[model samples]
Target: MNIVIVGAGLAGVSAAEELRNQGCPGQITLIGAEPHAPYERPPLSKGILLGDAEPDSTIVHDAQWYADHEVELITGVPVSEVDIDTGHVLLGDRHLPYDRLLLTTGSVPRRFPLADRSGADVVYLRTLDDALALKSRLTENLLIIGAGWIGLEVAAAARTAGGTVTVVEAADLPLAGVLGPELAPVFVDLHREHGVDLRLGTSVTAIEQRGGRTLVMLADGHQVSPDLILVGIGAEPDDHLAVKAGLDTDGGVLVDAWLRASDPHVYAAGDVANQEHPVLGRIRVEHWDTAIHQGRHAARNMLGQDDPYDRQPYFFTDQYDLGMEYVGHVGPEGYDEVVVRGELDDRVVTALWIRDNRVLAGMHLNDWDAIDPIRSWVGREADEELRNTASRLCPR
Candidate 1:
C-alpha cells in the first residue's frame, strides 16, 4: 500500500512520521515544493529575521532521519494535479498511485494589489527563502502594509534592529478584529512604545517607485518613502489541487470531524483543511500547534481510527520581551464580553472572552503560567464565581 502525502511542511512531515510510527509497512512518499527540508515557520519572522537563529536549524529532520526511516522524500517539486478518479497524483508527466492521500498543503500570503501593479518590490514572508531575503532588507527603513500578527512581529524585529518601520493598517487598531477592542491596544502600545510609526485607520492607495526609492501614498493624503515594503495582511488556503479535483471547499478543503475530505478516500489537515470542529463548528487554523496535532490525528483517521479532531485552536507569538499563548478560537460569530486580568502596562496580562455566559476563548500575554487554568476556564460557564478568576489567575 503506497501512501503519497502532498505538502512537505510541518503537517506533511508529521503525518509521514505518524504513519511510520503507526507501523505502516508499505511505501510512504512525502513531496515538497520547496527545496529545503520541512522546517518550522514560527522562527522565520522572529528568530530568523532577527538573526538570532540559522535557517538550517529550523529543519525538523535531517536527511539521515529520512534515509534511516526509509521514507521517500521528494523536494523542489509540486504535485500539479490530484486525479481523484485514478487515485493518483500527477506531477508533470509522472503519476504516483496512492492507497491513501493526505494534503497538508498549507497557505499562501494574500498578495497586495497595489504593490504588484506599481512595480514596487514588496516582500511577503511565507517560506524559508523569503525570511532570509527579508532579513537582509531589514537593514533599511521598512514600510509594512498590514498590522496583523505577522506584520507586527516583523515590525518589532525591525525596531529592535534599529530600523525605522511605518505600519499602515486599515483597521482602527492592530488586530482589532481578532483580539477585539480590549486586547488589541496591548499590541498597539507595544509597537508605539518601541518607536513603530503606526498609522491605524489608514489604507494605501498606491505604491510608486521614484529615483530608486519606494513611496507609499496613504488614504489620508500622506506619502512616505521607505526603503522596503512588506505585506503581512493575512493568508489564504492553498486549495487549488483539492478544488481542481472537485472537492468541497469553503475557503479551504471542507473536511469532516475526522479530517476526511469530500471523498472519504482523501484526507486533509493543517492549513488546507477546513475541518469540522465538534465544539466550534467548521474552522480552519494556520497555527503551528494545530498543524502538528492535526497531522497526527489525520494519520490515525487514515488508518481507519475514525476519531474526531476536537483539539482547541492554539498559537503563540514572541516579540521583544513579550510572549503570548492564545487558546480557543474566535470566529465570525464573535464574543459578547472580555474579562481582563493583570494590567497591560505591567506586561503581564490575561484575557477571557465570554459569549452567552460561556467562556469561548482565553489568552495569556507575558503570563506564561496562566495557560493551564485559562484552558480549563474556556468552554465552561463564566458564572459569577468564575468572573472573580482575575485574582486567582494573575501572573506570579
Candidate 2:
C-alpha cells in the first residue's frame, strides 16, 4: 500500500504519522512547498509574532525523524500535476505512483485589492515567513484592515509589543460572523480595553503610499497614515489542485463523511476539505484541532475502517488578559438566545448559544474548566436544569 500526502502542513503530517501507527509498511511520501521541514502554524499569529518563540520552534518534526520513519519528505518542491487517471503525482518531469493520496493543501489569506492596487507593501499572516516579517515591525504603527481572527490576533500582538494598532472592520463587532451578536461584544470590549483603536462599522476606501508611510482613506471620509498596512480579511481554501485534477470542489475540495474525495483512492483534510459531516452538515473548518483529528480520521478510513468524522468544531484564542475556547458550530443565524453561566463583567464566563432552548454552541471566556460541560451541552436542550450543570460538571 503506497500513500502520497500533499501540502505537508499539520493535516498531511498527522495523516503520515497515523499511517505508520496503523502498521502500514507502504511507501509514504509527504510533499511540501515550504523549504523548511513540516511546521506548526498556530504560533505564527501568537508567540512567534510576540517575539517569545524562536523561528525554528514551530517545526513539527526535523528531517531525521522523517528519515527514520522511512517517509519520503519532499520539501521546497511543488507538485506540478496530479494525474488521477494514471495514479501518479508529477513533480516537474518526475512521477511517483500512489495507491492512496491525501490532500491537506490548506488555505491562503484573502488579498486586499484596494491596498494591492495602491502599490503599498501590505502584509498578511498565514505562513511563518509572514509572521516573522510582521514580528520585525511589531513596534511600528500598523493599520490593520478587517477584524477577523487573524487580523484581531495580529492587532493584539502588535499592541502587546508596544505598537500602535488600529483595527478597521465593516461589521459592528469583531468575529460577529463566527460568534454571533450575543457573544461578539465580548471580543470588542476586550480589544478596546487593551488600548486597541478598533474602528467598528467602518471600511477602508483606499490606501496610498505617502512618503515612507501609507495613508488609508476610510469609507467615513477619515484618513490616517501608518508605517505599515496589514490585511487579514479572512482566508480561502487552496483547492485549485483538486479542481485541476477534476475532483469536486466548492470553495474547497468536497469530501464525504469518510473524508474521502469524489475519487475513492483520494482524500482531503484540514482547511482544504469541505466535508459533508453526518452530524454537522456540510462544514469546513480551518482550525489546528480539526486538521489533526481530520487527518487521523482520514487515515483510519484509508486503512479500511468505515468511520464518519463527526467531531465537534473547536478553536481557541488569547488576547491581552482574555483567553477563550469555543466549541460546537453555530452559524450566524443559527442561535436565538445566549445563556450566560457566569458574568461577562467578571471575564470568567460560560456562554452558550441556544436556539429553541437547544444548545447550538458554547464558549468559555477566561473560564478554562467549562469546556467539557460546554461540549456535552451542544445539540442538547439548554433547559434551566441543564444550564445549571456547569458548576457541577467542573467544580474548579
Candidate 3:
C-alpha cells in the first residue's frame, strides 16, 4: 500500500505520524507547499511577534526526525492536480500513484482589494514568513483592519512592543460575531485598559501611501496615518484540488462522520474539511486542536478503523494578562441565556452559553481552572441552583 498526504500543516503532519504509529506497511509521502518544515501557527501573532519565541522553536518536528522515520518529506513543491481516475497526483512534470490519499490543504488568509497600493506597508499573519516580516516592522505606529482574534492578538503584541496601536472594526463590538454582543464588551474593555484606540462600527474606505506612511481613510470621514497596517479579516478553505477532482464541496471539502469524502479512497481533515460533526451538525472549524484530532481520526478511518470524529470543538488565545480557553459548539443564533460565575471586573470569569437549561458552550477568561468542569458540563442539562453556586461550580 502507498499513502500520499497533500498538505504538511498540523493536520497533515498529524495524520502522517498516526499512520506510522499504527504500523502501516506502506510508503508514505508528505508534500508541503511551504519551504520550511511543519510548524505551529498559534504563536505567530503572540509569542513570535513579541520576541518571546524563536521561529525554530515552533517546528512540529526537526529535520532528523523525518529521516529517522523513513517518511519522505517534500517541501517547496505543490501538487498541481489529483487524478482520481488514474489514482495519481500531478506535481509539475512528475506524478506519483497512491492507493490512499489524504487532503489537509488548510486555509489561506483573506486579503484586501486595495488597487495601486503596494503591500510593502501591509501585512497578513498567516504564514511564518509573514509573521517574521511583521515582527520586523512592529516598532512604529500600527493599524489593524479587523477586530477578530488575529487582529486583537496582534494589537496586544504591538502594544507590548511599544508601538502605537489602533484597531478599526465594522462590527459594533469586538468579537461580536463569534462571542456574541453580550460578551463582546469584555474584550472591548480589555483593549481599552491597555490604551488601544479602538474605532468600532466603522471601516477603512481607502488606503494610500504617503511619504512612507500609510494614510487610512475611514467610513466616518476621518484619516489616520500609520507606519504599518495588518489585515486579519479571516481565512477561506483551500479546496480547489478537491473540487477539480469532482468531489462535493460547500465552504470546504464535505466529509461524512468518519472524515471520508464522497470518494472512499480519498479523505480530508483539518481546516479544509467541512465535516458533519455529531453534536454541531455540519460545521467547519479552523482551530489548532480540531485539526490535530481530526487528522488522527482521518488516519484511523483510512486504516479501516471506522471511528467517527465526535470530539467537541476547542480553541485558546492569549493577550496581555488575559488567557482564554473556549469549548463546546454554538451556532450563529447563539445561546438563549448566558450564565456567569466569578467576577468579571477582577479579570476572572467563566461564562456559559445555555439553551433550555442545557449547557451548549463555555468560555473561561483568566480562569484556567474552569476548563475541566466547563467541558464536563457541555451537552448536559444544568441545574439552576447547582450552576449558580460559585463554590461547587468551579472547584479550585
Candidate 4:
C-alpha cells in the first residue's frame, strides 16, 4: 500500500511515524511546504525568538531520522491538488498515487488588509522563517496588533530583547474570546506589569511606512510609530485540498469521530480537521497536543483499528516566568463562575471555569501539580470545600 501525507507539521510527521511503527510495509511519502523539518512551533514565539534556544534544537526529528526510518521526506513543496477519484495528489507538475491520504495541511496566519505597503517592516510569527526574521529585527520599538496568545507571546519576547513593546487589540481585554471577560484581566495585569503599552478596545485603521519607520493609525484617531509591526490576529486552516475534492468543509475539513473524512480513502488531522469530538461536540482545535494525539489516533484508524479519537483538549503557554497548562472545554455560553485557588497576584494560581456547577475547564499558572487533578475535575461538580480552601484545591 502507498500512503501519502500532505504536510510535514507535527500532525503529518506523527502520522508517518505511527504508520511505520504499526509495521505497515507501505511506501510512505511526507510533504512539507517549508524548507525546515517538522519543528515545535510553541518555542518560535518564546525561546527561539528570545535567543534562548537554537533553531536546530526545536526540530521534531533530525534529518537522519527520516532516512533511517525509510520515509520519503519532501520539503519546500506544496500539494496543489487532490484528485479523489484517481486517489492521487498533484504537485506542481507531478502526481503521486496513494492508496490512503492524510491531509495535515496546518494553517496560515491572517494578515492585515493593507496591500500597497511592502511587508518588509511587518512580521507574522507562524513559521520558522518568520520567527527568525522577527528575532533579527527585535532591537527597536515593536508594535503588536493583537492581544491573543501569539501576539502576547511575541510582546513578551520583544520586551525581553529590550525592545519597547506596545500591543493594540480590538477587544476590551486580552484573550477575551477564549478565557472570557472574567479571567481576561489576569493577562491584562500581567502585560501591564511588564511595561507593555496595551491599547485595548482599539483597532488599527491604517499602517503606513514613513521615514523608515512604520506608523500605525488606530480607530480612536490616535497614531503611533514603531520600528516594526507584527500582526497576530488569528489563522485560517489550509483546507483547500479537502474542499476541492468535494469533501464537506466548514471552517476546516469535516471529519468523523475516527478522524476520517467524507471519503473513506482520505482522512484529516491537526489544525485542518474540524473533527466531531465526543465531549466537545463539533470543534476544531489548533493546540499542539491535540495535533499529536489526533495524528496517532488517525493512523490507528487508517490501519483498520476502530478506536475513536476522544481525548480532551489540552494546551500550554509560557511567558516570562509564567507557565500555564489548560485543560477541558467551555462552550459558547461561557462559564457561570470562576473559582481561584491561590493568589492571582502571586502568579501561582489555578482558575477553574464552573458551568452548571461542574468544572468545565481549569487553567494552572506557575503551578504544574494541578494538571492531573484539574483534568479529573472536568465534568464533575466543583467541591464547595475545595473552592473555599485555596490550599487544598490542588493538594500536594
Candidate 5:
C-alpha cells in the first residue's frame, strides 16, 4: 500500500513512524512546506529564542535516518490540490497517487491587522524560519502584541537577552480567554516580576515605520517606538484543503472518534482535526499531546487497525519563570470557587475550578502533583475523598 501525508509537522512525522512500526511495508511519502527537515516547535519559543539552542537541534530525524527507514521526504513542496476522485495530490506540476492519504497540515500563525509585507519590523513565531528571523531582530527594545503563550514566551526570551520587552493585550487580563480572569493575574505578576511592561486592556490602534524604528500607537492614546515587534495572537487550522475536497469542515476538519475524516480513504489528525471525544463529545484540541496522540490513532486506523483514541487532554507552557499546565475546559460560566492545593505565596499553586463538588478545570503553576489526581477526577474514576483531599474547594 502507498500512503501520502500532506504535512511534515510533529503529527505527520509521528503518523509516518507509527505506520512503519505497524509493519506497513509500502511506499510512504511525507510532503512539507518548509525547506528544512521535521523539527519540534515547542523549543522555538523558549530555548531557541533565548539563544541557547542551535537551529539543528530541533530536527526530529536527520535525512539519512529517514532514508534508512525507507521514508521519502519531499520538503518545500506544498500540496496545492487534493483530487479525491482521482486519489492524487497535486504539488506544483508534479502529482502523486496514494492508496491512503493523511492530512496533518497543522496551523498557521495569526498575523496582526496592521502588518504588511513591506513592514519588516513585524514578525511571527510559527516556523523555524520565523523563529530565526525573530532571533536575529532581538536588538534592544522589543514590543509584543498579545499576551498569549507564544507572545509571553517571546517576551521571556527578549528579557533574558537583555532587551526591554513590552506586551500589549486587548483584554483586561493577559490570559483572560484561556486561563480566565482569576488566574490571569498570576501571569501579569509573573511578567512584572521579570521587568516586562505588560499593558492589559490595550489595543494597538496603528503601526507604521517611523525613521529607523517602528511606531506603535495604542487605543489609550499611548505610543511606543521599538526596534522589533512580535505578534502571537493564535493559530487557525489549515482546513481549506479538506473543505475543498468536499469533506466535512467546522472550526477544524471534522473527524470521528477513530480519527478518520468523513471520507473513508482520507483522514485528518493533529491541529487540523476537530475530533469527536468519547467523554467530552466533540471538540477541537490544539495541544501538542493531542496532536501526537491523534496522529498515531489515524495511522493505526489507516493500517486496518481499530483502536479508540480516548485520552485526557493536557497542555503546558513555560514562560517568565513559571510553568502553567491546563487540563479540561473551564467552561463559559467561570469557576465559582478556586481551590488551591499549594500556597500562592511560594510562587507555586494549583487552582482547581470546582462547581457542585466536581472538578471542572485545573490550572497548575509550578505544581505537577495535583495533575495526576486531577486527571483521575476529570476521568470520573477516582475516589471522592481522594479528590476532596487533592482539591480544597469542598462545599460548606
Candidate 6:
C-alpha cells in the first residue's frame, strides 16, 4: 500500500517512522514545507537563539536513517490540496496517490494586526526562517509583543545577547492561560530579575518605522522605540487542508480516540488533531508530547492495531536557567489548590493541582521530583496522607 504523509514536523516524521517500524513495507512518501529535516522546536528560542546549540542538533533523524529505511523525504514543498475521493495529494503541479494519509501540518505563529506592509520591522518566531531573520536583526533594543512562553524565551535570549528588551502584554499576568494566575508570577519574576522592561496590561496600537528604528505606539498613548521587534502572541493550528477537504474541524481537526478524522481514510495528529483524550475525556490539546504519541498511535491504528489511545499529556519548556515540566490535565475549574514542594528563591518549585486529596496535575519548574509521582497519581484514588505529605502542607 502507498502511504503519503503531508508535513515533516515532529508528528509527521513520527508517523512515517512508526509506519516503517510496523513493517508496512509499502511505499512511503513524506512531504514537508521546511527545507530542513524534522527538528525539535522547543529549543529554537532557547538553546539555538542563545547560541548554545546549532540548528542541526535538533534533527529527529539524519539523512542516513531515512535512506537506510527506504523512506522518501520531500522537503521545501507544500501539499496544496488533498483529493480524498481519488486518494491523492496535490502538490504545486504534482499529484501522488496514497492508500492512507496522515495530516500533521502543525501550527503557525499569529502575527499582530498592525503587522501589515507598513509594519516591516515587526517579526515573529516559529519556523527556522523566522528565527533566522529575527536573529539577524536583533540589536541593542528589542521590543517584544506578547509575553507568552515564546515571547519570554525570546526576551531571555535578547537579554543574554546584551540587548535591551521590553515585553508588552494585554493580559494582567503572562501565561495566565497555561499555568494560571497562581504560577504566572514565577515567570514575571524571571523576566524582571533578568532586567527586562515588562509592560503588563498594555496593548500595541500601531508600529511605525522611524529613522531605521521601530516605534511601537501603545493604546495608552505611550511609545517605545526599539532596534527590532518580535511578536509571539500564540500559534494557530494549520487546518486548512482538513477544512477544505470537508473533514470535521473544531478547535482543530476533530478526531476520535483512535486519532481517526471524519474520513477514516485520513488521520490527523500533532497540533492539527483535535483528538479525544481518554483520561481528560473529550478535549483537544496542542502539546508536543501529545503530537508524538498521537502520531504513532494513529499510524498503529491505521495498520489495524486495536490500541486505545489514552495518554497522560506531557510537555516541557527550557528557559534561561530552568527546565519547566508539566503533566496531566488542569480542568476548566482550575486546580483545586496548589502545593509548593520547593522554594522559589532556590529555583526549584513544583506546583501540584490537588482535588479530593489526589494530584490531578503538576507543574515542575526546575524540579524533577514531581515527575514520577504525577504519573502514578492519575486515574487513581486520592491518598490523604501522601497528598498532604507530598504537598508539604502538613507539618514535617
Ranking by TM-score: 1, 2, 3, 4, 6, 5
On a 0 to 1 TM-score scale, where does candidate 3 land against the true structure? 0.96
Best by TM-score: 1
Clash number for every model?
0, 0, 0, 0, 0, 0
**Model 2 clash number:** 0
lDDT per model, in order?
0.90, 0.88, 0.87, 0.86, 0.82, 0.81
Predicted candidate 4 versus true structure: per-residue lDDT over 77-169, tens digit per residue? 888899999999998899999998999999888767672264436777899888988998777888888899999999888888888998999
The most accurate candidate by lDDT is: 1
In candidate 1, stretches whose alpha carbon ends up further than 4 angstroms from where it belongs are none
With a 3 Å backbone cut-off (N, CA, C), the pairs that clash in candidate 1 are none
lDDT of 2 by residue, 314-379 (tens): 999887778889888886457777776667677788877878788888889887777887888898
lDDT tens digits by residue: candidate 5, 265-315: 999988898888776678777778887888888999999988767876788
Kindly list the per-residue Cα lDDT of model 1 for residues 1-396, writing each as its tens digit.
688999999999999999889988889999999999999999999999999999889999999999988799999999999988889999878999998999999999999887867877788999999999998888688999999989999998999888999999999998887799888888888899999999999999988788987888999888989888898989999999999999899999999999999887899999999988999999999999999999999888888787899999988899888999998987888988888888778879889898998988999888878888888888999987787765577832
Supply candidate 4's per-residue lDDT for 154. Answer: 91
Q: Return the TM-score for each candidate structure.
A: 0.97, 0.97, 0.96, 0.95, 0.93, 0.94
Tens digit per residue, CA lDDT, model 3, 39-100 = 99898998999899999999999988888777899999999999988889998798999999
- Estimate the lDDT of model 4: 0.86
- Clashing residue pairs in candidate 5 (N, C-alpha, C atoms within 3 angstroms): none
Task: Output the better candidate (2/6) by lDDT.
Answer: 2
Pick the winner on lDDT between candidates 3 and 4: 3
User: Which tens-of-lDDT digit does each residue in 1-396 have in candidate 6?
Assistant: 888889899888898899989998889889998899988787688777887877788899999999998889999988999988889999889999998899999988886777655555667788776776666555568888899888988888888887899899999999887677778888888889989999999898887887776777988778898877788888888999988888889878888888888887988888888877766777766677888888899889988897768887887887678778888777676666766676776667777777665667777777676677667666555566666656663122
